[model samples]
Target: MVTTQRLPASLTPLDAALAAVLRDLAPVQPIELPPVDALRCIAAEMPALRAYPPHDVAVGDGWAMRANDLVGASSYAPLPLAGLPVWVEAGAAMPDGTDCVVDADAVDASGPLPQVLAEAVPGQGVRRAGSDIAAGRTVIAAGEPLLPRGLLLARAAGLDLVRVRRPRLRIVNISKGGLAVQLIADTARLAGAEVVRLKAGPDIVTIANSLDTGGCDLIITIGGTGVGHTDAAVNALARRGALIAHGIALQPGRTTAIGRIYTTPVIALPGAPDQAFAAWWAIALPVLDRLSGRRPRTTLALPLERKIASGVGIAEVVLLTRKQDHWAVLAIGDLSLDAIARAEALLIVPGGAEGFAAGTLVDAYMLRE
Candidate 1:
């Protein structure tokens, strides 16, 4: 089996490494799932099967009658009805030839013939057909998340299932299992991926065997990416398939690696939480987005509260907190757990330029969606 004998002579540019990671990647195939099960999944185009409220229905519990029949009716001058009006509850289909609803008190059924004491204009208390949803109209657009509101529309349209694309992500932890893997898995799940987690020792053969891409669209190996004696993730990837880049020009995650095995792309992250997190946001998430066909994530553009100083030739991850309409710098380069936890958003400083000055408007991605 082929193996990378040593560390990369020089770190690969972050942009170049990302391009290699995303080369020829495509979104996963769509699947049919119950609307409840599709929550948080990226939706394929889902057209409404039928119009909601297939027929006009009452919006409140009242007497269903012809609006024209109640003309000039009032509590002081009650108008006698020709026949007893239908008593309908809220959400019930409006009686045939009826156009509106009147309150219970408005209809005096105690007498032989009900007397109308209120007037209701047409559709005043009715929900019109097709108002909530139209037949053959797209309820959930492609690449949109399937939220509870979407499910309500689906159910109203008589749809039992929805079509969605949820990419399968396999995360292999090559270090002693701990918080790093859990953090990555949680992040992947939050990004709408189906995650399968596994653990492998530091042995090259074990890691190589765990690189199987049977049901996964992407693979991420946590740890075993540095030059330490036990760092064998990159070498194992070379043995299994191809090691495209073994080192990247990103601070806190310089030891990260990018490669491919069979048809699936693989990313190797440093064991440290900070470095792994940096590489994940900078490199892995873009690949995941391609696999899931997710729409572009929202980014907030706000002025910086303070100046940020970053070194040249290495991309840096900056954590920030929103404080009184400005982004306050929490931490840069080496990030602590507290800083990461407290950060509401994150910004990546490109490798070519110095950091932004205080009060410069910067685009940052929210940590939580």
Candidate 2:
């Protein structure tokens, strides 16, 4: 197995760790896919070929007629639906020369003809053409995520497919196939990436060096990142190329490592479930987002309900819960399944600060649970 190691101190600053590897990366080429499969993907360019609705349609079920025919009409004296008056249902295309809609609720349609008891004006209750969207107009920007609202817009614009940068990822794990592999695959796939999870057994060094990375934009090793003797991913990747950072200043994630093999970026994460989960979001996911042409995830502002301690040199990721109007830290012995399962939000403590006291206003990222 290949061997070379760039030893990092017990803890490395998170910002330094990220900068070393992200500087050389670029987004992958955009691919065309159906709108349903492109959720969360960054749009390359989206222009509508036709305007929404495509024609002037009625917004209500009423008589389609000229406003001049309804002049001086009131509850005391109603106008009859005579010449040129056309009966129109909601969403029906408005015929030529019609300019107003008189809802059935405001008129009596029994006995003779449909009539309006109230005066009507031009463009009243009538949706004009191109009001929603115009043909050939840019609907979405280049870097915006294709959220549900964006999908609706695309569908409305008569688009059945969208162009997006779908990243291809390789996830390396110690197991051949199981829940762990499934979880990692789901995480990467849900973020709009095509994933391939590889298993590296006892001879992780050999497997790591031989793992197929032909079309992969990024590789994430799910275990063998800690100080244990069996951990050899750091050395294996170093021999292949450059090891950016071996450790990050993060709680439950200090064992994380970021590097590059030839032209593909590789990241090493701890085996423990909680630590690996945190590291995925704190590190690996960000790399995937950039490679897939997406912007950073947004965070919210929330106040800490109680005091929480942390070392000055390393950043801490604390799980928080919603308590009435504010957020409170959910303390646990270590990051465990129970702890993560109960968390509703994540509180970040940067490396420069020592700790925080009660009522301290801090920025947080809400968990998707």
Which predicted model would earn the best lDDT?
1
Error of 2 at 57 (Å): 1.0
Root-mean-square deviation per candidate: 1.9, 3.2
Candidate 1 Cα misplacement greater than 4 A, ranges: 1-6
TM for candidate 1 is: 0.95
Question: Per-residue alpha-carbon lDDT of model 2 for 1-369, expressed as tens digits?
Answer: 434333464667887777777887899988888888888777786654577778888999887877887799997897776643677988899989889887766677665676678999998888887787776766577877777887887878878788998888888885333554566678787787887766777355574665556888998887667656566777766767778888888877788888887778888877777777777777887888889877656666777788888888877788888887677878522576776878887766778878888888777777762
Q: Write the per-residue lDDT of candidate 1 for residues 1-369, one digit (tens) a residue.
A: 434446767889899999988989899999999887888888887654687789999999999999998899998999997878898999999989999988889888788887999888999889999887776677677988778887888877778888999999999998775788988999998887899999998999999999999998999999989877677898899889898998899987999999998779999998899998999999999899888788888799999999999888889999999999999999999999999899999999989979999999999998866
Candidate 1 positional error at 19, Å: 0.7
What are the lDDT scores of the predictions, listed in order? 0.89, 0.76
Clash pairs, candidate 1, are: none
Worst 10 residues of 2 by lDDT: 1-10
Q: Report the error of model 2 at residue 207, Å.
A: 2.2
Q: Could you say which candidate leads in TM-score?
A: 1
